[model samples]
Target chain A: MKVLVPVKRVIDYNVKVRVKADGSGVDLANVKMSMNPFDEIAVEEAIRLKEKGVADEVVAVSIGVKQSQETLRTALAMGADRAILVIAADDVHQDIEPLAVAKILKAVIDEEAPGLVIAGKQAIDNDMNATGQMLSALLGWSQATFASEVNVDGDSAVVTREVDGGLQTIKVKMPAIITADLRLNEPRYASLPNIMKAKKKPLDEKTAADYGVDVSPRLSVVKTTEPAERAAGIKVGSVDELVAKLKAEVL
Target chain B: MAVLLLAEVMGDDLSVDSTAKALTAAAQLGDVTVLVAGGNAAAAAAEAAKLTGASAVIAVSDASLANGLAEPLAALVVSMAGDFEHIVAPSTATGKNVMPRVAALLDVMVISDVMTIVDGDTFERPIYAGNAIQTVKSADAKKVMTIRTAGFDAAGEGGSAAVSDGAAADNPGLSEWVEDKVEESDRPDLTSAKIVVSGGRGVGSEENFAIIEKLADKLGAAVGASRAAVDSGYAPNDWQVGQTGKVVAPELYIAVGISGAIQHLAGMKDSKIIVAINKDEEAPIFQVADYGLVADLFDAVPELEGKLG
Candidate 1:
């Protein structure tokens, strides 16, 4: 079985994002960028499957602007056999909607025919947890989402999902799509030697037009604004004062 | 425009509060038709019919719908796609898993975690995990969305909508339910709780985490944990409150020993009255807290719990 993992490039999670002053969108000029943390978990899981001898090859694919090449290189360094980059947008600020990205991925899946596809549950930038499920719907395959643990046996994958009430486990057939959650695994940092070898790995490039899928924005941004800041609070001296104040105001 | 709301069903009954919250958002657009799909369809539909702003209920029942799997639920919503102008569900785990597939089958994009209904075609939703809010206008004729339950109030009772039977979509049988090990807790649900008491890494160890729960029990509040605490294995996954976990906006949120990272702040900053109890004077949680107490959690938590008595 071959595992196909899709990664995304997004603003590093540590940086505090700022909204553009003009209410257009987030300020993205010169901000540090990296593979989405959740996507990094997906790539790590795919590589682990290969290391376990449960899969033959791990192919990593990314969809976005040309700068996404760096994200794919990181995945290659982490142990993906090769990488595919689909340049759907030119501007770094333009985020391709999940619908269009899923369509283009469907076109790619038709060509690769990988048995399993793993993707990030959501990107930190848009926080849209839709693409993996959209791809599953378009392909008529099974989907296991928000997965924290994924185990593969003969032809089935048992996935443990983090849900509202508690943990829920499900068994999905092979050739399915799995989306990684935060607790999935801790991804490893690429060693200097592995980073150098990743340069020799093949990195194939394509365009949305190459797959005949139109990547267009479905939702137009009317405005963007910073969330309202909380007002400065006063410090309470002791537990007695804290309880008294809370009871007077809240209870 | 007519709105179709996918009800969140738990076992035999509808999760009334969450479904009602989504109803409030749906009512903003147009008349709502609540779609109740699960094992005990009639029971959930009966509850859905009582929600305010609900004009009708479509009850879809099937054995395969017992466990919340995306394939059959997505197919069920797709089957009814032709009748409604907009399709929405609560942005819960099950809803998030299924709605995007429905939107994809209909060839439209999903506007997730919507915060406000600016107009019929425009909405404000949080992006970058609540750091930035984006208002958007949909170009698609049929809008598919998931309601962020935190953004709206629960609909009142006093509505008598008609309950109609809807056909359950055929199960694709691609996935099967294993068992759900749900933490049986007597406390109120986290999102709907009026008062919440959360612990942080400062609580130190799993055994020491009991003081946070004792305080929650005394106040009849739900128990919560910061990502720091949850990652440290001091609390269950469901107890986590943060950007990647659950978003909560209770009447009062008391943080015990939580330093409050930006991710954790995104979840509870909207709370009406916030209180932070941490030893660190410069903890980020203090900035958003209505009342900040600089003290050791081990000593402070016990003192607070006893004082509440």
Candidate 2:
């Protein structure tokens, strides 16, 4: 069985994002970019599945600009057999939405026919958290989202999902979709040797038009503004003073 | 516009507080018709009917919906989509799982975790982990959204809306419900709790988390933890409060020993009153705190507990 892992290049998690002064969007001109943390977990899970012999081949696909090939190369270093980059037009790249990404993935799935697709539950940039479910709906396939644990057994996979209340375990058949959560696994760093070898891995390039996807955003960002800031208050000298302030002001 | 509000139900009863808040959000759009879909949903439907904003309740009881597997639940919602111009649910895990599918099937975009309604088709939501707020306008004929219950007040119980039976669609039979391992806690839920006490990596070990629980118990608050604490195994994942975890806007939030990573602040910065207790006066958490106390939490927490006692 083949496993398809979709990775995204996003602003590094540690960087504090600033909104552009023009209110267009976030300022991402020279920010450090890396594979989304959750997608790294997804790639790790797919690589582990391949290592365990449950998956015969691992294919990493990314939908973004030309720079996204670097993300796919990182995935190859992690152990994906090949990579595919669906290059988006410059205008489309600025406003790519989850629905459009899902449409493109659906087209890719039609061609690859991977038994399972693993994706991050949410991207740190948009935080849409909709691609996997949208792909599942578009394909009429089963979906087990927010998966913290996944154990593939023959044609069925038992997934432990993190829900609002607690943990829920469900069994989903193969040819399904799974979105990786935070606690899924710790991703491995690409060794220098592996990074060098990833350069030789075959990478196929395509475009949004090739998939017959419009790549147009349905939701328009009317405005972007910094959230209201909370001003710092005076520090209390002692526990008694803190309690007094809490009683007098807060509680 | 007619609105369909998905009810979050546990067992035979509704999650009243969450559903009530969802109803309040739905009321902002139009008249609400609550959909209670689950294995034993009659009681939940009755409870939803009591919410002030609901005009009607549709109870759908199906064994397949008992666990809310996404396939069947999405199918059920899509089957009933024609009657409503808008579909809304609380931004819980179930809503997050199912609403996108409904939106996709309807060929519309989902505006997620909506903090405010700007109209029938526009919403304001947090982006970049609450660092920025974006006002989004959707031109889709049908609007699908998930409301953060923390941003809305729960509708009171006084209505006597009529409850009617709703039809269930065919189960895809592609997934099976195994079991749920829920953490049984007597304390209030983290999101709805009026007061929350959170610990961070400075708490040191799992044993030291007891101090957090003790302080929380004293104040009748829910215990929360930063991702560092959860990742370190000092607390469970469910107790995590951050961008990736649960977002809470409680009346009082106390951060103990937390350096206030931006991700952690994204979850509770909306809180009405925030207090920070950390040995490091320069911790970023102090920036958003309403009151700052530069002291060792190990000493401050115990002293605060004793004074409260």
- True-contact fraction per candidate equals 0.86, 0.73
lDDT of 2 at A207: 97
Model 1 lDDT, residue A249, Cα: 95
The structural similarity of chain B in model 1 to the true chain B, as TM-score, is 0.91
Give me the runs in candidate 2 sitting further than 4 Å from their true place. Answer: A91-93, A249-251, B185-189, B205-210, B229-239
Residue range B1-309, candidate 2, lDDT tens digits: 899999998767799988899899999899899999999899889888999989999999999999888999999999999989999989989999999999999999888889899998889998877888889999889999898887899999999999999889999898999999875887888977899999999999999999999999999999999989998999987788988777789989999989999779888999999999999999999888888999989999999888874
Q: What docking grade does candidate 1 earn?
A: medium
Best by lDDT: 1
Candidate 1 DockQ vs. native: 0.73
Off by over 4 Å in 1: B185-193, B201-214, B217-240
| Chain B TM-score by candidate, in order shown | 0.91, 0.92
